[model samples]
Target: MASVSTIYTMGTFLSRAEGLGQRVRVLVEGNWITGTPLSCDGHGVILDSGAEGQFLVRVEAISAASYALPEATVPRPRPHEGSGDRVRDDADDRAYEGTYATVASLS
Candidate 1:
């Protein structure tokens, strides 16, 4: 049997993502809770979901979680490379596609 490399869990992901300033999607029921990772430990994660919005998700309740893959293309788009409207729209689509990717929390 191949030895497992690392223990991959939402707690680990949330803790790491918080440091990287990354947004994350937590799967609850059949919906995805999209938010920025504020803090996390072995038990739960606190998510900042915009203006005065924050939610704590228990480690066990987070059936799944994900972050966007880093793009090597460029930080920001050129003059007319990509439109913000399109980017926002695509975010939803990407989530449904099972990748469950989200924009970085880096502002």
Candidate 2:
């Protein structure tokens, strides 16, 4: 049997978050916080919210964090030779599906 570890300690999360330039949505004490992660330590995390301001969110205040890859980073799939497939891989397909769903739902 293969065991999986889904639990992340605060220290573990901070260590993993270092140096990744991605936008993040953090849940803190009944409120949603959004920003780009700058740095994090045992005490807290620094988030840069463009045009708004940078925030020092304490570790204790954070309930959850979800990091999203910037739109510019996602590689746009080009049309393959003769196939009509819109995406190059499963990951791209999932991204496109979400975008298509959102656009469709608005109508």
Candidate 3:
């Protein structure tokens, strides 16, 4: 048998955009939270509601502190290449960092 871990995070809806290579829906604990394109940069996303905050999430069977919703849910910024891009990776890192930082700071 294989052992699995889960990850969790809490962050605000930064921003949502369309026309990206992928469209992913951000969810919290299996609950629909919001949707945003995967083209986000390191600056973090700007929510359409113009609100800034954080959210709490959990990842099942994963050790990662954070997890990306799914490619099918969130469209990729670039589809032609069929490979991950720097921008998307950076955005993910930023998102995780933001959440982790916020939690750490609070503690």
Candidate 4:
């Protein structure tokens, strides 16, 4: 199996590279996610959430685009009595926007 990396939004298009101007759909299964064109690398795709830190996804298969997002149900946040709304400071907000992806093949 070949490995491929990519960046994508929950319901938006996927970004192939830093500035490749290419977009595609993505499907994830368990710890393996696959997509077309297979980013320049063959490891994993970085998810673009306007957040920091790159997510490397190891691709297992690359055919028919058969994969689904992992089913994760986050519990509702408990309300705090006097906790001010959590807000990211200016610097923190800026740092959160940078994102990238790395793909690699195993075996």
Candidate 5:
């Protein structure tokens, strides 16, 4: 759902949205293109869409836009966290297994 809709150019909308929040929601790809506008000009704009990564879009292409202005609340945990799997850290394992000891002996 779009919070606000505007008929301004992408650059104009971005400049205005900066006061509210640089992060904007625009219907670029039907999949995922909502993110913070990294840079914009009269031609194209670069959007740093999280996960989806940054991409360029023509200013003229963007019409009405919206913002996912997150209310002041606790951030939600990412899906990768606590997925019943221990995150592997080779350095920690190496330290536990005393790889340093082997290296020290060689030195």
Candidate 6:
């Protein structure tokens, strides 16, 4: 029998991606989706999909996988920072106009 390669789960791949600061491309339901990996769990994977915004995808829906490395990329947000409702374009060094909510801890 031919040797079999170990199967890697989507969550496993995504977790590693978060550390490497890289984006991943996944094909789901005949659509090619590309984005920066944010977080992943047993149920789904979250991605920071550029202009399209973030996406939460179920692992079971993935059909294919690949890496999407952009020529230039934005720096990932700090751990303490909340979700980025507005993303800046590094190429132009300008911030796009958008509304973001401020989260306050009611301690």
TM-score of each: 0.57, 0.53, 0.20, 0.26, 0.47, 0.57
Output the worst ten-in-a-row residue range by lDDT, candidate 1: 98-107
lDDT against the true structure, per candidate, is: 0.68, 0.63, 0.33, 0.38, 0.57, 0.67
Cα lDDT tens digits, model 6, 7-64, are 8987777778878978888777766677788888868887786766777888888777
Worst 10-residue lDDT window for candidate 5 reads 98-107
Candidate 6: residue 17 lDDT (0-100): 80
Candidate 6 ranges with C-alpha deviation above 4 Å? 1-5, 71-107
lDDT of 3 by residue, 55-85 (tens): 3233231122222344233333563474654
User: For model 4, where is the 10-residue window of minimal lDDT?
Assistant: 62-71
| Candidate 1 backbone overlaps, count | 0
Please identify model 1 stretches exceeding 4 Å from their true place.
1-4, 68-107
By summed lDDT, the worst window of 10 consecutive residues in model 2 runs over 98-107
Better of 4 and 6 by lDDT: 6
What is the C-alpha lDDT profile of model 4 across 69-95, one tens digit per residue?
A: 333343335547678866545665455
Give the poorly placed runs of model 2, Cα more than 4 Å off.
1-7, 69-107
Question: Model 4: which residue pairs collide?
Answer: 3-42, 5-44, 5-45, 6-45, 42-104, 43-103, 43-104, 44-57, 44-103
Winner by TM-score between candidate 6 and candidate 5: 6
Worst 10 residues of 6 by lDDT: 98-107
> Positional deviation of 59 in candidate 6, in angstroms?
0.7
Ranking by lDDT: 1, 6, 2, 5, 4, 3
lDDT of 2 by residue, 1-107 (tens): 99987977654565466665667767776666666778887688877766567777787777777775444443465887779765466766566542310111100
